[model samples]
Target: MSKQSEDLLPLWTLSTTETELPLSLTEPMTPSRLTELRAVLAALAESPIATLEAHPLSAPADTSKGISLGRMSPLAQELATLAAQSTRSVPKAAGNSGEVLYRMVVPAKVAAEVSGGVLEPMISKAVPGGVRSALVGTNGISAHASFVPATAGAAGGSAATVGVAAAGAGALTVAAPLVLLAVAAGASAHADHKRQLEIEKITALLEKLHEDRLDDERNRLDGCRSAIDKATAILLDKGKIGLSLGLDTAVHTIDTALASAQRRITDWRAALEKLPPDKVELRQLNDAIAGIESPGSEFYVHLELAELAIALKRRVIVLQAVEHAQQDDGNPFESFTNSINLDAQNLEKIVTGLRDVLLRLSTLQLDRSHGMRDFTFSSGAVDKLLNTSHRLRALGDRVEAGRSQSDVAIEMVQKVDGSIVVLPAMAAE
Candidate 1:
């Protein structure tokens, strides 16, 4: 290959043992891992001999041309921007003829422990000469280049020196052994760099996916809270008249149910706050997301139950009004009948709505692993409402029967003739 092509290849690639970081690059970075990576990058920014730059490669092996930042993943793009901002000025070596670049590829785990404190130690130990410049990417790939000054007739120097000499002589000359070593080293490093970059891209994708899942959870929580608040307001309004109409039992039951719902909402909010900020271990990530998505506390079911309770309370109040009207001398029979019929229709609707809410509560699949308990408070409230429904139905039946008897008496009086009609006992006397 031409000299231009050769310059694009990394001089040497060093990596952590494969067994140490067996995770696929496409896998998510655990919260700890993300933290470690940030520390390592920060240290790289402060290193004296190393200056990190972002190489936006189109493909892992296509290092010749860099793609735009828009084409990269969010994490990758973010790191690239950071790398730009944190880049230190590269100190130029006086009278340096050229530079030999060295590249290292290590797992994020190793970089955090070793390079986070200082990069010079690791650089001096890994590369043959003093590194002049370096570039690091989110993929755990760091490329370093050392400056070498060209002098006339320099013999038995490093491979870079020999190459410079060969080029100046305008002849195809090779220091056979040094050239072989350089070729082998560059080839190995290039291979490792390519593999590491591939893995980093995968990690970026996983991070994005995890973030999307979290967004969905937040939105769901917001909707649940809004619904609960609306239901609470309605229940509170209904409870205001409880004392006036001797509905203390109904009011207390509903208030307790509302308190239970509010408590669950608080628990869910706290759980959400405790979720990992960035990413989590693959083994635990699925469980964590599931917990948020389908928590056992049942906020929605509680809201429905509360609304049902409110409907039942309203019906009871209407029933009381109808009873009071019956005793009023000005109340017409037709008006009393109309009010009773309306109450009956409303009662039927409440019963139907309650049944639907109960069915939903039964079929709901909650995440029981998240310490979910039984709905004792809500269940008790439902039972109370049901008993009230039955009693009201019975009372309406009795009222209708009494009304029928009164109608019969009135008809008999209207049918009586002007002359007195006496029973058989009275005529005999």
Candidate 2:
């Protein structure tokens, strides 16, 4: 796998280089073997050096009866492959070819379980309360600590700190106490440096992810604003033909609201640029980002209101046409009445849904400390559009009622001379 793929996978280097597999891994796939593996993993989860030392696998060193790589399960096969790769990569001393190296690739589910259950808790316990909060609280960013162990020679030569001869019983070779202390200090320093590098890597990844999300939100906002502008322009054109009713005032309100929202977004972008390189400042930034209006909510509401305005404007035009047609003699008014009634019904439904959206907006819990109010729609603009819808609906109702009453009073009649006359229904009767 590529380096990126390896980083995504949960991989561990085995503590020992053994060509023959341990019974825990080589044993037949059973519940017992699974239990044993889990136990071993739990023990090794904290250490950079993953070893079966002092465990049950330490005994039974006979390699002759061990299972071959082909006979193992898929999981074991992968582990064996990794082990072979490790053995080949590590440098070997002369005449010490018996030493082997191993690595293991754990399943994703098991990795997550171990990370959350074992690793995170261990980290939480190890760090100070303040540092822990800075690392994992409210920011929605998690720290995944990875450790790389110091390499050991292929021979049973001493590892980084100590060396043992392979031919003899493993006897302790103690260096001077001062020398041991110096080695311990150097290792500690190296561990700290490695940890710092890992932290930087994780931080960079999270920053890129956050930037991508922000870019998407900005694009959506721009699209919505463009839609609202187009709709407003169409409405203004329609108004020029003498059908306008309080349109300029409503449009002005919408423009003002949109401008305010745009300014707020610009301010947020600026804030992102000027963030100080301090822990507390970063945490505050995270909180502010979280408080941002849910992606596109601010502009989406305005876009909906703009659509409703255009639809209502069209209905008003229809009403004017109907009035002009009514001035002529004996024109059928049934279609006009039905059309007006339908418009009224549809307008009511649209207005109700818009009102519901406004209600939801009002209920959003924006943090005033973060200046989130500027990112929301203006109340004045929303109210004006809603009130206009109500007026249009009322106008439609009056037109429909007047036309129906007029129809009832007029009747078409054919007299003895065979000429048709339209007169009051009472006179015709």
Candidate 3:
């Protein structure tokens, strides 16, 4: 690629995007809220289409929605034009389009994380095939947008009241590996506690068998009674006594093994019952396994003994069913064989529903707040979300701004009216 081509590759601005989720329909959005929303959208839009080009399936519906850009709202058009006119004329970035533009917009980071890059290609595919992006010279343009919260942070360094709220809209992070290690270690320790139980069961069964073996007093008395009855009945009944004695000996052998097994089970149960509540999940599992008689259940018992570590290990399994699906790689188009699919994904579906509900409640709150012309949030959640945006905006501005590929942001300034995020640009075909 030529130097010009490289420059054009980065998103160029035709106009800055301004989200128009009507004040009447939304909680009056603050500058910081708008900033945060825009930053998130930008983060979403930053991902390159080439990164997603290999996927055979289409992007999800919401992802497409996030990248959407069309005829601007009239007020938006006016504001964009005014913003362009106000910024003092300067050198056009690299090549010469000479056309001053609005702040191009894109989805914020939250939207990107929530939807992935599904929307990027969807919008591109929708664009007319013949309409190639032909900017004058090599300067290609990126037109993008975002949403915002209605609250601003305070100045007295009271981050809680005026700045970023703790809930909802902070940076995305995960627990440390050490924490996971601890969880696994704890699980393993618990599993060890279970092994001791199985041993105790075996020990008890052996004792029960031995104790039942030598019951001489009762057996002798019964035998004497049998002899008396035989004498009264005559010679034919004496043969029956001998048969009964033999039968009793054989029955006791079988009875001893059964009693021993039962005792072993009782000991095992008692040992496991001593475990803490956290280990309860495992204890119940063992009990369930013991109750079953199938070979599968038997296998479960032995394997669990060896793999007590499995219970301790926790992992995020993505595309888990893909392994089985790969068995028929001889046919790619088969629905059952596609392991990495975009469909009725359970996790994504849940998040989508959650975002929708939040949006709906936000809309209702906006209607009630009368464009934030009043302090009337029905719930603390709305207020908290709004506050979080402001803090993110202030912090994000410090970290972003004037720090594009070329510009080095030294001691960042909070110049923009709202929140911000510095990340890659989204590709709209």
lDDT of each: 0.27, 0.28, 0.25
Tens digits of lDDT, candidate 3, 303-412:
22222211111001111222222343333112221322333243333323323322322222111223444555556645544543343233232221122221100000
**Model 1: lDDT of residue 61:** 32
Q: Which segments of candidate 3 are over 4 A away from where they belong?
A: 1-117, 120-127, 130-138, 141-322, 333-344, 365-429
Total backbone clashes of candidate 3, pairs 3 or more residues apart or in separate chains: 40
> Which stretch of 10 consecutive residues in model 1 shows the poorest summed lDDT?
406-415
Residues 1-429 of candidate 1: C-alpha lDDT, one tens digit per residue: 101111211111111111111111222232234334334533442211111111212212322321111213232232223222222211121112222121222223222221111111112232222121232233433433321112111123222321132233211111112111111222222322322343344334334445454333333322232233233223222222223343444434544543444454444444434545443322232243232222222332333333433333333333333333335424322233344445445434443444333332233322212224533445554554444334323323311111111000000000011111100000000
Off by over 4 Å in 1: 1-296, 300-304, 307-315, 327-337, 343-350, 357-429
Measured with C-alpha atoms, the lDDT of residue 113 in candidate 3 is 27
Kindly list the per-residue Cα lDDT of model 2 for residues 139-169, writing each as its tens digit: 3323322222222323334433112122222
TM-score for each predicted model, relative to the true structure: 0.16, 0.17, 0.19
* Clash pairs detected, candidate 2: 17-100, 17-101, 158-162, 158-163
Better of 1 and 3 by lDDT: 1
- How many clashes show up in model 1? 2
The residue pairs in collision within model 1 are: 101-145, 102-144
